[model samples]
Target: MKKGSATVAQLSEFDEIIDVRSPAEFADDHIPGAVNMPVLDDAQRARVGTIYKQVSPFEARRIGGALVAENLARHLHAHFQDKPKHWRPLVYCWRGGQRSGAFVTWLRMVGWDACQLEGGYKNFRRMVIDALAQQPATLDFRIIGGATGSAKTRILEALAAAGAQVLDLEGLASHKGSVLGALPGVAQPTQKKFETALHAVLSRFSPDRPVYVEAESRKIGRVHLPTELMEAMRGSPCFAIDASREARIEFLLRDYAYLGDDVADLQRKLGCLNRIISNETLARWQDYAAVHDLPALFTELVDQHYDPLYKRSQNSNYVRFGDAIHVSTDDLSPSGIIAIADAILAKTPVRADAR
Candidate 1:
């Protein structure tokens, strides 16, 4: 009767991790590496649910028990028949209740050392939420601040490559943290998934070392930053990157090359700003796209929209913006970004104990 805690380290001790929730539940979110071996699949769960609501509980249990028994037989015969007697597995369902209990009963009956997660996926999710609410306060952060097309993301990557700890918010959210931030054909994860991913990354860093991250507003696309983390970032020391106008435009053209391939998507994104910018202005931007004049359109967009918006919001949002260490680069190329990463590391002192 081995028992596992809801913590990641405790859960990682098992030989195999099995999730018994329905496919849809697993799809929405689950422990990162747990294998899905649903006790009742999506359709079966729905059918059982319908029976429970529309029919008598007694009748529903009768039908569900028969279904469960048949599914268990198939799993034992098809999936577990080859396994040895001493196989150890961690099993869990929604709330560490009936579904996992039933599965565990059968597995133990078959002579396997199977254990149930004490609180299940719900418990794991709660742990992540609580961590997100509290953990950022323990970390020391250095934010990277700059206007659009400043290659902040690229610089973060280079820093990570140089053995510095970095929290890439944009990468985690799968949105570039702007109006045109959404990556084409790549969908963002659910909020729960994002939080889970964030927790995983944060837990890996030591509290003593500074985490380098790009400056982001509270919201990144549809997902919002954890309140504690947002507040910490606003007050943290920052590195302000300054690049030339020509350099920024060139950098953007390369970074957002997808927009050129699908001009319609570009126009659609531009149209979203109709409320702030006039319809005529949006139409003009669309016309620029119609002729594939992205450089021209992007230049105007930064000067008219992104730059002004950044100037107004950043100073107020990030309290330390005025004291940010300025890192100016005339080149925004790959080598240039690596050079910028080197420059930042040179000025930014890693904590004495970080080594």
Candidate 2:
């Protein structure tokens, strides 16, 4: 009904969230569901800042205010013209600063129920950091360990389908966790965005039941796992998925078939390991790509590279590696993956009252 402020914890009480920061600032990270309604777009914000520093703060405000007014008018005419009078929106900017303040003031002027986020995106970011630091410690984590192509991600999916709680790190990171793990054309989120998503998922689970997650390195791609989450994962008990070399190669070929679309890109990604792999071997792998023999390429990559790296990391990083319950599977077909998931759920007995 009137202009006011809501803390980060109260964000969900609103009907819509509007971010009035510049495009670049919004792209970097904002509240998870916020829609960008920048009062001053990137170029305008830059122009205003330059004037503020070199000319005068008063001049800058005058120019920025005009720009904000014009942009806000355009947004309301194009975007909010159809909104009902009762529509409630939470608006925010870099620190509940002038950009967001201006937007909220005008929205309230129109008699729509609008409010500003107190401390803005910075407040929400601090909440994510604080939650990640303490939440993982309260839950029991079960790490899913395996060599590359072991279908650990698929197995986690099946586990979730079977009603077990899972924390899908790769899913959140939009990565597959290997040298060639990047999904085609899908960019990973900013580290803050990843952390915010992680905190959101973590907050939804009950602490009494064990949370299952794939065993991953400290960094998933460009995003580094929060220190507490990484440490908790390393210290958790593990359940290893053991698949044979042939099965792994077959599974990897089927799962990563998208690589076939761009052999050159595949070769380039594989070439990242030139220092670790002998040139002759790398050349042979590239040759396999040239001939369109993907199974051969995957075989060498798994048996020689991924397997050894996984063995070393799993044994060293996860302290409970020796005690892990190993689930042996002959293949990674649909049925085979389901069987593995069933075996894992059997091994991980849950109390009836556990979440």
Candidate 3:
């Protein structure tokens, strides 16, 4: 790379990555680990855009330039005051345009080694998309398949804790993959952000070792999986978990105790299934929720909704589901889950071809 510019491929060569786009743009998506130091804030950017459209480009630039200078001075005193003179940073805006150019020029004049991203965040976004489309094929993945409430996520966590590579999609998405999967007081990330996170995690795994991930639908709540990754997971070998129904219900009751706190919201989430479940059954479930009879509600939900749906989706989507190695357990306690993870690790061997 040159003294004044770097490419997305050279991200790690810099001491810090700075995003000079507005906060809104940064929140939507940016290069992972990049810090936000917007030259123009959300309101200022909108104001400048309006001026450029309604008044004149020169007028907008004049006003925006002043605002950018003021913000840069604030950042210098507040954020960059303690930085060493030898610090090197990569700075970028939406495009390799005026905002980042101005910031980089200022930093360079201040005696720090600063470079602008050649194509800015647009380039990084392109890199993320391309990586997601191609990277899944490079890794060896093992799918953990089970009906809802079978502690698949817990098992994946245990696998990770046991020094195995694990990708917890639900943990990434912030929503469990179900109708009741919406977590209270938690919101899902934008689809682009989710893909960025997924790409980051996938990039870290060793191809020679198998990555354990839960079997997820194409969409987890509002965010959808990359088509290539979904295909990769669906075709991967699976470990089917067959925990007893009673055990599953008990597990769910404990895992989803938050749902019991808001009976009205729980009923509303269940009402979403009115189209598939008969009115009488829906009423019965609603009544159970109204009375805080979680055990009955969970049991009915598993028997009627979750189990049947899991059977159909797993069989149809997972190509290797028929040949899956079944792992049965009546115990989903913490120790038992670890034992299960240990057993799976013992059975799974690293692939020589992955290297």
Q: What TM-score would each prediction reach against the true structure?
A: 0.93, 0.96, 0.96
* Model 2 lDDT-worst window of ten: 346-355
> How many pairs of residues collide in each model?
0, 0, 0
Per-residue lDDT of 59 in model 3: 100
Q: Model 1 over residues 143-185: C-alpha lDDT tens digits?
A: 8999899999999999999999999999999999777889988
Local distance difference test, each candidate: 0.87, 0.90, 0.91
Instruction: Select the stronger candidate by lDDT from 1 and 3.
Output: 3
Q: What is the lDDT of candidate 1?
A: 0.87
Q: Report the C-alpha lDDT of model 3 over 162-205, residue by residue, as the tens digit.
A: 89999999999999989899999998999989999999999999
Question: Cα deviation of 131 in candidate 2 (Å)?
Answer: 0.8
As for model 1, its CA RMSD to the true structure in angstroms is 2.6
